[model samples]
Target: MRVDDFDFELPPERIALRPASPRDAARMLVADTRGLRDRVVRELPEILRAGDCLVFNDTRVIPARLEGRRGDAAISATLHKREGPRRWRAFIRNARRLRDGDTIAFGGEVQAVAADRAADGSFALDFAGDEPVEILLERAGSMPLPPYIASRRPTDARDARDYQTMFAREAGAVAAPTAALHFTPELMAELDAAGIAHETLTLHVGAGTFLPVKAEDTDDHVMHAEWGRIDAATADRLNAVRRDGGRVIAVGTTSLRLIESAAGADDVIRPFEGDTDIFITPGYRFRGVDGLMTNFHLPRSTLFMLVSALMGLERMQAVYAHAIAGDYRFYSYGDASLLLPA
Candidate 1:
């Protein structure tokens, strides 16, 4: 499909500069076969079925944005994916000034050598110390906020707490799984009382998620690989839920993509741990996820394409229109959307 099919004009004011004070206080736009309905995040327990399971990405967002220098030129890097214990693939600004094997010195005594520049302009950064890369990131890096938000305003100390979700445990993701941002301990207790089950999986959301689909056609676009894991125990439970006629609603596109990657042609989910570059566009058959809860996405983004696949192109277009007209927030720190297809 033409990438232009996903285009929509969003007012600049729709972008959320900050998250709602109490995460659960954020607005939610629910779209289903029945119709579109206005709602709030805290009301999720009542909106979903008792037997439905909400799958969440537990991958914690790392302070992946780094500012460093090599000689006279200033360089900024966002570490996207870990290639090894001491190496990562990073998108570089002022990359033209960098060449293979040039050491860039970051704050807190952190340093890395640039090499293996990919055609996409991302470079392999091999760190120069025995200390864990996470330690280096902590000393010199800040939270890798979405470019949309970062461009509008500078990242501050608040984002360190706000960008992380209640479920964050396994750290690796460069980006937060924003849909789960609305969930809180109180909301979890309510969900438990309402008999709405929840589960966790790991999908280290990379900076690539923020990359725009520059390709004119969806067919020409390629998705960056993201590491994820679904152990046997969790897989068995999820399979049982489906076997017993319960819905598995993915809380974010990260969870949904990983679930689909682990599912077989029979629609049975299995244990999986590896990289998935699954590009979900319209016409892709969903195997594991019954519904999705996600933030409003950028126009012409891969995430929008994934949602269009879950629902329908025309349907999602209307859903987004309703959201915009209703003054709903947009992007990473934005209002939520619950999409349940017929």
Candidate 2:
């Protein structure tokens, strides 16, 4: 299939720029083999069965966006992936003006030397610091919001808290596992009362998640790798649920990808920790997850393709159209959806 096959018309106003005030008050569009149902995020516990297991990505989003000056030229940078304690792959704005050996100063507290350029136009920068790069980023970097949100100025304090998930624990992801954003403490209690068990995994979302597919043919598109891990305990719990004839509900695409990557041919999930470049599109057979809770995705994006893989392409198209017609918010900060396989 071609990348254009996933394309759709999305109105500019439908793109959500902010999260719902109460978080759980966001709308949810439920899609299954039968049809679509309009609902709210708070209705999750009532919608799911007692034996269903909810899997979530515990990876935390870091302040990865930075503003710096490269040899007197102002530039914007977003750290994509960490290579070492001080080395990282970063997308630098005005990268064309930067060259190897050029030094960039960030917030006047840290300086990084441009080492090399990757084929995708990303730069490898080596920070001049004995402290870990993560620490430096926490102090100098800002939240890396999606490009669709046009900031009138620079990132403010509100974005620092709003863009992050309430349940964030382990630190690594550059982007939040958006589906988890709808969850709240009260909603979690409701799930517990409803007998739905919960487990956590880790998938450090990378900057590549936001990259557009430039290939015409979907098969020719190369997916950018992201680090992920499924621990022994989580693996055992998921397998137990499957053996008990319970549903494995992945909280987001990140969790779904990690679990699917760890699934063996024997139909059991195994402990895994490594880089994954799994590109899920329509016609891909799901191996681990029985259901998915995810947010509305961008038109023609890989995330939309992944959701289409779970639900049929035609069904997803109809669901998206309904969402648009109903004036439901879209994207990371928008509403969510609960999808069951046909």
Best by TM-score: 1
lDDT tens digits, residue span 1-342, model 1: 999999999999999999997999999999987799999999999999888899999999999999999999999999999999899999999999999999999999999999999999999999998999999999999999999999989999999999999999999999999999999999999999998999999999999999999999999999999999999999999988888888999999999999999999999999999999999999999998899999999999999999999999999999999999999999889999999987
What are the clashing pairs of model 1?
Answer: none
**Poorest 10 consecutive residues of model 1 by lDDT?**
237-246
Q: Which stretches of candidate 1 lie over 4 Å from their true place?
A: none
- Residue-level lDDT for 55 in candidate 2: 95
In order of appearance, the predictions have TM-scores of 0.99, 0.97
Residue 193 displacement (Å), model 1: 0.6
Displacement of residue 98 (Cα, Å) in model 1 is 0.5
Q: Count the backbone clashes (under 3 Å) in each candidate.
A: 0, 0
Query: What's the C-alpha lDDT at position 327 in model 2?
Result: 97
